[model samples]
Target: MSLPVLLLVILALAAIAYVTGRGRAFRTASGDIRQLHSLPAYYGWNAALSVLLPALVVLLLWISIQPVVINNSVSALISEESVAESSLDLVLSDVRRVADGLDMAVETGALSAADARSLTSTGTDVRALLGSVGVALGSDVSEETLDAAQRYRGMSSYGAILRSVLVLAVGIGGFVIGFRASHKDFRARNTVERVVLGILIAAASIAILTTLGIALSLIFNTVEFFKVYPAADFFFGLTWSPSFGGGSELGIVPLIWATLYISLIALAVAVPVGLFAAIYLSEYAGSAVRAVAKPLLEVLAGIPTIVYGLFALLTVGPLLVDIFGQGGLLGLGWMKGGTAVMTAGLVMGIMLIPFVSSLSDDIINAVPQAMRDGSLGLGATHSETVKQVILPAALPGIVGAILLAASRAIGETMIVVLGAGAAARLSLNPFEAMTTVTAKIVSQLTGDADFASPEALVAFALGMTLFIITLGLNVFALYIVRKYREQYD
Candidate 1:
């Protein structure tokens, strides 16, 4: 059956169920709902769901399997001799293209009368052959053949009308059924609650499924990549280069070192500033001060990373060049490149300050007031109390926040792309040029290199490595935070 017909059937059943349920719930001797087992609405909902859910499931399954089945049948009918010369996969692809072309022609009203007749005759012959084969095999003809046979069984104006009517009937039935069940006796509250819970659970499951899908895709592609490029070269080779041509080497050491160097510089800039900001806000700031400072701090987080990248490129880079470049003050001409690890790190650190401070501030505020009072009561100064009692109590949480920030810095792309040099260098100088893994991945993947090539496949390997590193950091941070939370509790 056509998609419309299937949908119509489902909707009609649901509507019928709903109307029936509501009628059962609401039909009263005195037209009053005070004596019902549940509300009239609940019965209607239950009945509608009963009718709709099963039919919808069946329809979904049918739709999901139909294309594959039909494609296979079409492939079989095209003759094994035609495909034997080429690969089966290539033949299947050609069959699909032919099917798609016919569909497009029909949709656009572009098929000649002669062509349409020929196609119809071919379709009929194929369907009959498939049915005979299925029967001879003593099994149900393949679902594909069966579907195709049914589809080509007729071509009349009423076929479209029938499909439409089926869909309309299903929808109307479901609505009527639901309405009928919406009676005083129906348990509407319970029914609605169940539905809400199901929706929430489905949404949660989707998030988890999406994460798993991404991880699996990365793993699959990386495995394929490793088949072409040795794991040792990818992981530990000192030189970093990925050529798109047949001869390519995909070493990751320089990229890894660059990533580490950038992250370290970012942390070095962020930790001290963010820590100080958190201390001041949590310990010293009054309500009014906090109200102003907190939003301003959050505003920093709200700024787009791209904006930070531009700032790094246009503003910070030139400033650095003037101060430390070939003709700058103190005459340290070694710092020539305006865009370097230091520039990217510094901008990235500024971008991450809010994340670190916001988290640390919350943890600091959660520290027991009693601890501070006790330290002060023991003759410690206010600063001493905070230093000795509060900071220690909040240390784990602060560490967790910092680790999260480190992950952010590592994964950051725009800032490094804009400010960090593209050269994959192993220099120790912060002022020298460098490139990071993310930059290389973006550069390599955006071009027209074949996906099956080792050069292109290397991007997947890099992505997998990035995923593992970030995943580990987040998990460790969570573990430490949980441990610290338990301690405080």
Candidate 2:
């Protein structure tokens, strides 16, 4: 059976188990629910959980393990000489693709089951036949590859049959156990609650575990990079030039400066405008005005950064150059090109405006109305109340909103790539074309360099640095929130 069909059967079995267990509970208690330890629904849920969880777990494990076993077994049959023409992994990938193509041809009725089993690459146009069925093979299939692919399909078919039988048997066993245990005094509710708590804990730990995995990977690669390239030069060198060949500077200082410079410029534009808009929406705007205006302002955040990058590249870049470049509008000749730090910063700031505005608006609204009333009652003007009382109460949350916006600005890639030129340097001039750490990370990894070399490994180091910077920002934001938060209750 197919995986989906098998899954549906398991669910049907669990449902039947639920109904049976509930009926058995009622019969055991002599139709007197008062005599039961728990409710009828609890008994039903306990049986459902007992049968469903084990079956799903087994199904997941079988699906994951079957592929590894089949791949190893099939790959072992592929001759070393056949793989010498190409990489073993690449040849194996082609083998799997050929297997899939044959399956599709059979499913579409293009090939008879008997002919498919007897077919060989020696006489047949395997690639052409596969292309006809819309499963294009990447390379011509050799006899060895064809043999391996057939084995792969056979093993997979056998595994699927075995998986279906085993899953159903385990599910039935669990159902029998649960159904027999549904007695009048069984703590069905407690058992169900414990299982649910375990599921919840697993769900919660997913993010923490994923983050740990990422951190470890980055740390390992960063260590590999530092072993070949001096850590001091990477951290403190003034230049940023990475050559696939030796003698690459691979300095991060200039890139770090550019990142901070652009981020600061972006925040300078975003924080004030977004905060003012938030204050007006929360304090001054009418109900209808607030409702319409807030969503409209937030629509800026929904725009893709690529569109913003295009705007920076085609629209804003030329506009700035027209005004600021060599003797044009204001007779100023400071700017040379359109792509510069200022261009990306302006576009990034516009994109981040809604993030700051929406969050700050929510934070400001969360401040108790009594603070505003008390300030006004003390003969302070509405403006004074907002400036003094409301703003102070909402400072922690507003700081959080601003810091989050900063994070967004710092990590942005597309806008920096298209708007900021690919030059990494330290310059006081905002008009100078420069790149950030994220842009350089992309450039370094995509370059023609060996993955084992320091050049490509440096991407991991850059990633680690960026992580540390963002982590510091978050830690500071948390400290600010905890230290200043008002306990209104």
lDDT of 2 by residue, 1-489 (tens): 999999999999999999999888999999999999999988998888888999999999998999999988987988888678767788889988988988999999999777777889978998888899887666788888889988988898999999999999999999998899888889999999999999999999999999899999999999999999999999999998887878899889999999999999999999999999999999999999998999999999889999999999999899999999997697687789999999999999999999899988988888888888889999999999998899989988889888988888889999999999999899999999999999988988895577899989999999999998887887787676666555654
Q: Provide the TM-score for each candidate, comma-separated.
A: 0.73, 0.93
Worst 10 residues of 2 by lDDT: 480-489
lDDT of each: 0.75, 0.90
TM-score of 1: 0.73
Question: TM-score winner among the candidates?
Answer: 2
Candidate 2 clash figure, as a count: 0
Off by over 4 Å in 2: 81-85, 326-328, 331-333
What would you estimate as the lDDT of candidate 1? Answer: 0.75
